[model samples]
Each structure stands twice: as structure tokens, then as C-alpha cells.
Target: MKLTKEIQDSIPFQYANDVRSGKITTGKYIKLAVDRFFQWIDSAEKDGYHIDHNSGMHVIEFFEFFLKHTKGPLANEPVILSPYQQFTFYNIFAWKDENGNRRINHVYEKVARKNGKTAGLAGLGLYCQSFDDEEGAEIYAAATKEMQAKVCWEQAHDFVFKGIGLRKIGFKNTQREIRFEHRERNGNVRKGNFRFLGGDSKTQDGLNPSLAIIDEYHAHKDDGVKEVLESAMGARQNPITYVITTAGFNTTSVCKAAEDVYKDILDGHKIDNHTFIMIHDLDEGDDWEDPANWVKANPNLNVSVSMKYLKREYTKAINQPSKIPNFKTKHLNMWVDAAETRIEDHIWMKSDKKIKLANFIKNGCAGALDMSSTTDLSSLGLVSNPDENGIIDILPLLFCPSDTIDKRSKEDKVPYRFWKDLKLKDYIDFEGTDFSEDNFWEKLPVLIATHGNQIDYATIEDYLQKLEAIFLPKWWEYDRWSATQLVQNMTEKEIEMHPFSQTISHFSEPTKQFEKHAYAAEFRHGGHPILRWMMSGVQAYEDPNENIRYVKNRSTKRIDGIIMTIMALAGTITPEEDNNESKYNHEEFTL
Candidate 1:
């Protein structure tokens, strides 16, 4: 029943231990990732899973034995993986299912540039192709551009041509592919192929890949290549879809979408056992100038990317100023403008406790609306009165035109159609059919889909009336710019409509309060998927007077739901307190 020292000092757990002991510096996501590893190990057997240490180290030993540094200061030297890389390799190949197949088949790795990502993965591509006990394995280096795909494929090709182990074993190659053939003990000939598959390639038809190395995945503008390769892997017995990249500029890209899902998995909002996620980035509010903090982002600080090289880039960014975004994104592994500070995401996730809405319905609540545009998303945010525990429950009801759900979902890169169809029974706990018909609020879907190509105000008014009959909010607040008709209609219906001006003076205190509630874990939102997405994309703008308000710049994504939450929380504050400065310590809002 006891484990060996080698198992205790396994690469992943060793790195996790180092992180806990302060020997390693990283962000909260990495902390969560290591915790996930430990939790999985603790329950592996009960969950019909087990760890195979030899199988994990087999991949590592393969790299050290056959792969060589194709290009670098250590060119032609044997490929020796660093601690972080050892951790990555072991995780990829260690765990086994009940059937002894690879436990994790998909890997999402986000790290800073110049971290030897490509070389390590190129070696992995070779390992999966030549060994791994898979016959006729089809390995691919995939990317949006042909040249980009060739980068990894070329490194892998060079490793085979330049290295002694693979060459002596015999292989054949073309400009874009490498082939290996062997005869099994049963006298059956097995063949393997490794090549580049680009989105711009002439034909992606009729292909099967056992290992897909998606390099610099953030550069991909869409999911064409990723989806194609993923779908093609269905026939393989044990397939791996490996996406490796640094932080990027495009927030709505497929890579960012994958990152969002990965974050949810780490936050315990979603369960995905077959996917492995490791994100290395600087923690929020870290002083980038501090050399001590650099290791958090650059795991291979002195190994592949030198401290001197980072110093030079940092100096240039300081002098040029405009280059700061690139420096922060590529070197610090920060998503730069994509995730500009509004709130700490980890703290926001921590506050995502379940809410039994029925518990607070009769207590009354405050409502706010952000009717963005006739064609885009409109949000209705409701905040419940604080209970004796002082915890506020927030619920967001998003609305979009049914006809435009598909189009808008594609454009915004968020699932509008799925959210639109979400029934109240899925998220809300209406007490014993009192607020439901057939145990479901059929007409009161959480994400309402108004008919036709533009949001139907009449349908919104109707839903408001239904909500009004049940919750009886104290006041309904609206951003005055485009809600004239809806405001008039609701006011005539005897539903109190108060105009909440969208200004720093009106929003700053509430925004600060929301941040306070998030940090204190005093709010619950049922882990609403769409609301969490909006919160993650919010960017804050600060004035000279230290007033902060969420802003959606050209580069930024939508924050309509977030704005609605702030406005709704604003209505809950006493009018006298709304005009006064926030009582919370200013330093606490630094995040």
C-alpha cells in the first residue's frame, strides 16, 4: 500500500511540491493545474484509473535518447528536457485508463515564447510517430499557415536527418513528410508517417492523425485546422491533440476559446477528464520589472531564453512604450489587451457558488438592463437583497434574436444559440411548481430568445412582467441611451423604470463594490457560462481622479453583462451612498 520515492518525486508532483515550497514561482492557474493532478491521483483507482511511472518516463527517455537540438545555442547536443518539460511529458504519457489506454488525449499548453516549446514538441511528434507502440501512426504538425506548420515539421525532419538513432533505424522522407517502416515479430509490416497539415493546404480530405501538434495555436484566426485534425483522430486507438502556444492578441480566436474551457475545468465549473491543461503566466498585478517575478512566466529563464535577452526586450519596451504589449504578451505570457484588468478571474471563479433562487425571491431585488443593440446581445442582470450572511445572489438573463443566434454565435465566438435554449429548470430552483409549469419555467428561459432577426421589445416586456409578478424588484434600472421605447412601455405597465446614467461617477462605486464582493466571496451567480465569459473580457478604464469604469475598446470584447451587473448593484446601494466615494480601501482594488 506504500509508494516508492520515485513515485513521490514524480516530475509533476515534484514541480507541484516546489511550487508550494516557494522554490518555483508561477500564477494561480498553474497552482490549480497541480492541484488537479494531485486530486486525480488521489481518486484515480476509485475512478478506474492508475499511474504508470515507467510508461511516463518512457516518453522522457525516448526524447533524451533519440531527439537532438536542431537549432539553438546547444545545437547538435542531446535533447535534455527541463523540469517543466519533464513535468509536461510525464503528465502526457503517465496516467492510464481502465483499459490501459492513455488517460489524457488532449493537451493545452500556454507558455511564454522562447521556452523551447517547438523543439520539445517536435521531439514528441517524433516519439509518437516512431515509437509509442502504435502501428502506422499518422503524426501531423498543424497550423493556420503552411510555413507555420513546416516550422515544427521541419524541426522534426531535421531531428531525424541529423540525429544518429533515427537514421540508423532507417527512414524515408520528402520535402513535407518523413516515413518509417518496420516488420513486427508476427511478420506484419507497419508503416508510420509524419507531415505538416496547414489550413491553406490544397486538400485536408482523407486523413488520419494519431498525434497532432498544433504549434503557436494563438496565431490561428479560426478553428478550421484544429477541428479538422481533431475529427480525423477518431479512428486512432490512442490519439493525442496537442495545442501549444503563447498568449496572443486575438481574444476571440479559437485558441482563446479553448483557454476559456480550460479555465472552467480548472475552476471546477466543468469536468473534463481527458484533457490536460498547464498555463504558465505572471500573476495579476505582478511588477514585471522584478527579476524575481520573471520566472513565473519564463520557466526556462536561463536555459533557452536568457535573462540578458529578456532585459534587452524589457529595456526596448520601456523606451518605445508601444512595444510593451508585445513584450508583455510574448515574454510575460500575459494576454495583454485581451484580458485587461477589471477583476481577478480566479477570485471571480471562487465566488461562483450555487444559488437556490427561491431562497431570495420574496426578499425583493434590484434589476438593470444593458440593451446593447437591436442585433447584438442585451443583458438583464438581477441582484438579490443580501441575506443575514451578507451574501448577494446575482442572476443574468441574456436575450438575443432567435434568427441571429447562429450568426452572432459565430461572429462573437460565444455560444449564443446554446445559451438561448437554456431552460430555467437547468439553472433556477423555483419552489415546487409555484414558479413553474410541469417543473419547468417554459416561458422564462434564463437566456431568452426573442423571435426574428432583431430583439423583440414586446417579448422582453412580456418576460419582464412575468419576472415582476414573481420577484417584485424594488426598481428596474436601464442605461438611458437606447431604452426609450422599452422604458416607456414598462413605465406604462406600472413597472418602475429608473434611468441609470452610464458614467464613472455613477458606476465607479458599484464597480468597486462588485470587486470587493468578488474578493470576499460574498456573491453567487450559479457559474453562469455567458456571464462568466463577459466578466473575463471586461476591461477597466481609470480617470485621473482614480474613478474606474468598464470600457469595451475596439480591441476589447463585449462587457454588456458586466455593465448590467454593475448597474444592478448600483441600484441596491442607498442613493445617499451612491454619490459618496467608495468606503473600501483603495489598495484592495489594485487587482
Candidate 2:
């Protein structure tokens, strides 16, 4: 519904002169109260809240009655509630009942960062503690981290102690909860108290809560924490739960779940039993750099926020989009792509279907292995014999240390226990090995032993000879056109691979360079979904200058399949000829 200024002005302001004194009459007050309530209810409806109310004022009255006799400092504290704040609190806390018994409701809001979320939450927490149904009602301001949870608690304490005329409510600074309890039901007499607790599953479990406010919910790493907190509300008839957060980085986390739930409401996929409100600036195509977007994203513009700070931040975002994913996600309220280049999910899934371990043995394959000691997985790829057109079929094998395995043992070195656990000891022959070992002999033997069709001593030695004397030299000086043709042909087949360390480490930079020159270059790997897929899994190195030294940042995921595809391409080796005769002799070459 379109909200006009006249309609907005009709709502009651917390202070007499803030809007107009005439708007404070019981009828106008009730209407304004009802309108504020419905505004939130409507927002909740849009977010999938289910309610059977012809008027939202009824719900508001139910909460008002529930809180009417409650005695506390907040009951008499002068409250200058905005029309918007009034509506938000009523909708968030009030719900109708068939038995006329007051029941609490759930409220979830996806708002942009720095929109007075903390203050608003704190105000509601104090309100719930002071005036909600239960005497000495417990209120909580929770967040993903200790600092964030504490901030909400601190804000609530400040509002109680420092806000005009609120000091009469016994606000005591203590090691644990701030006490606001009153003994008599008379005006300004202590009756009930509210306490603040840090946001943690363990800390939240012991509290019997009347209301719970989760701040910065998008950052919550544990979904289980939410589950645990919700259980505490089961005993309260009208316990309220509020989840507040800004836009999240990607769809895999709690932020994404909130976004999805919001979408489900709009799409009519879910009915709203709870209130969900989302206030963001840009829709889809709105310029992310525009300063106007900031104003739209933050509704509290001149009230709770400084325009000068926003302007400074906006300028920084426009200039360097790549440097700040969190800033862009939170301040600009935009979804940042996970990486510069993401491999389409469809391509990766399809490639996975074509990978058959048996095919490598059946086709007389050759192999390539890339090993890493720091920050990467050891990867092996095997290629099948060339077809009439001279293209190789590739497959991949990836190995990494287990999570339980300690990186540092008593010696303060990365433990080799993971290598043994993954059975990598058999695949990797590190005996008498060092970084300076000759490239051809050092890696070739291990590759052959692990993946070769024939593993006898003589056969293995002979195969190494063929690869070193013939394959290595020809591969180094192979004609660019022939090599390109071979790679192009292999691209048609669905390749089997998982992410390996070496490919993930080097792929991003090369892919970036390739993308920059994609249209101008003749044989760009940009179109290769498999290559791009592997590149997307790469994590940035801690050292800015060292792009090649990357560790597997996400262990549950892999890029070994794409590494296998690359190695398959590398297997398109041909015999070298000297004076029109095939030469199968090794020659020493300087690195």
C-alpha cells in the first residue's frame, strides 16, 4: 500500500507537540494505535504472517490490557513513541486469541545496517520487561558475537538510565542484569525488572524469557542457537521473538535463510504467522554507487545516522568495489558475488556425472600429479589414450588432511598424520625428495606408480623413460595450434574431477587475466565451465604478493575435479622427432 504523508501524520507521536495535541484523543489515539498496529501486521502479512483480524487495533488493545497493571519505572517513563515505532512494537508483540488469552508473536525484520536496529531493539526489550504480561519479565538482546550482544544490552541500559524522565526507574549498574523492579503498583513505584544476557546457546538456555531480540541475526553461524532460544518461549503464553539483520553475503548462511523466508512471503509460498519487515534501498538494477541508495537503505537518515559518514563510505565503495564485501553487503545493502568468476552449478554437476574411475584403466591412461606442502591438497589426474584426432580423456583424484588432524604437532610443524590417514602415503613417494629434485623424474615416478596400468619395476622404469625422453621435450616445444586443437577437442567431454590444491592456487590469476583478454584472445579458457568452476573455489592467500600459495580454506568442498580436467589436457603428449626419425632418448635441460 502507498503511504502518503497525510496518512503518516495522522498517527500518534510519542510527545504532545511532536505531531499535534489534537491527535491524542482516545478515538484518535485508538485509531492511530490501530493504524500503527496494522501497518506492522500488513508488513508481517507481506512477510507471511497469518492473522484473522479485520482491525489491528484490537490486537494492540489486547497487549495494552496485558501490560496495563504491570508496575515498573518504564510504565511511568515518558515515552515519545513515533507512529512507526508504535506500529512496530504492537505488531511484533501483540496477537489475537480465540479464548481471549494474550499470546506472544514472532517478528523478523531484514533491515539495512545502521538503521537504529540496536536502539529500536533495546527500546522494545525495555518495554517488554517493564510492561509486558509477566511481572519481572526477562528480556534478552542477543547477537552472533559477544560484542554485538553487549552493545544491545548497553544501549538498553542507556535508554533506561539517561533518557528523559526514565531515571526514576531504579536503573542500577551491576556485574550482571540491570534491575528495574518496583514494589507497589502505583505510579513510578518499582514492580518488575529486566535483565540482559549475552547471546550464546549455553547462556540463553537457563533464562526464562518473556521476549527475545536477536540482533545482527545474519551473522549467526549456528542455526542451533536459534532453535535453542525458541524452546524457552514455549512455556510463555505470549512470548515474543524478534530476528533483526541486514543483507547477507551469500545464500548458504542464516542471512540467506532470512532472505529466502522473506521471498516466500512475497511469493505466497508461506503464510505469515509472524511479522517480517524488510527495508532496503536498491531493488535489482538501481545503481549501487548512487548516494540516493544510501538514503533509501537507511530510513533513519538524519535522525539516528550522519549523512556525512554515509557520503564518505559511499565514495569509498564506488571507487573500490572489490576490496569490501562485508561493507558492501551491510552498508550498501547489496549481494556481493562470492568470487570474481563463479562456475555455474549445472556445469559442475554434469561434469561429476561423467567421471568414471574404471575408464582411466580401460583406456591406457597416463598421469600428472601436483603436490604441495603448504596450504594446498595433493592432486592427481589421469588421462586416457588419445583418439584418432589426438585428444586425451582426463580424471582426477584429490587428497587433503582431515579436520581432526592437528596442523602443528609437538615439533610445531604440520603433522603428516593426515597424509597417512587419507592413504596418501601409497600415492605419494616422498622418499629422498626435496623441492630441488629434477622435475621429470621427481614427480613422474609417483604418478606412474599410483595410476599406471602396469606397475612392475621394469615396466614402470620403461614408462618413465618414454615420458622423459619423448613426452617431456615434445610437450615443452609443441606447436601452439596442435596443442590448442587437442585441448579444444577434450573440452567436449564431461570431465571428472574434484578440486586439488595446485589448480585452485594458480587458476584464479590466470582466469582473471584470461577474462580481461577473452574477446581479443583466440583460445580463451574463459568459456570452459570446468576450469572456471575450479577457479571459483580458490581462496585468497594471506600474503598479498604470493598468489600461488593458497590453502584449502573450505574443507567440506573440493576443486579436485577441475584439477583432473587440467591434467587430462596436459596428457595430450606426442613423440618428438629428430631429422624425421622418432627419438626416445633423455636429454638434460637447465631450468
Among these predictions, the greatest lDDT belongs to 1
TM-score, each model?
A: 0.58, 0.49
Model 2 Cα shift for residue 320 (angstroms): 2.7
TM-score result, candidate 1:
0.58
Give the alpha carbon lDDT tens digit for every residue of 352-386 in model 1: 77665664575558788888688888888688878
Error of 1 at 544 (Å): 37
Candidate 2 global TM-score? 0.49
- In model 2, the runs with Cα more than 4 Å from the true position are 1-9, 12-84, 93-104, 161-164, 186-202, 340-591
What is model 1's C-alpha RMSD?
Answer: 19.2
Model 1 residue pairs with clashes: none
Task: Point out the worst 10-residue segment of candidate 1 by lDDT.
Answer: 576-585
lDDT at residue 488 of model 1 (Cα atoms):
89
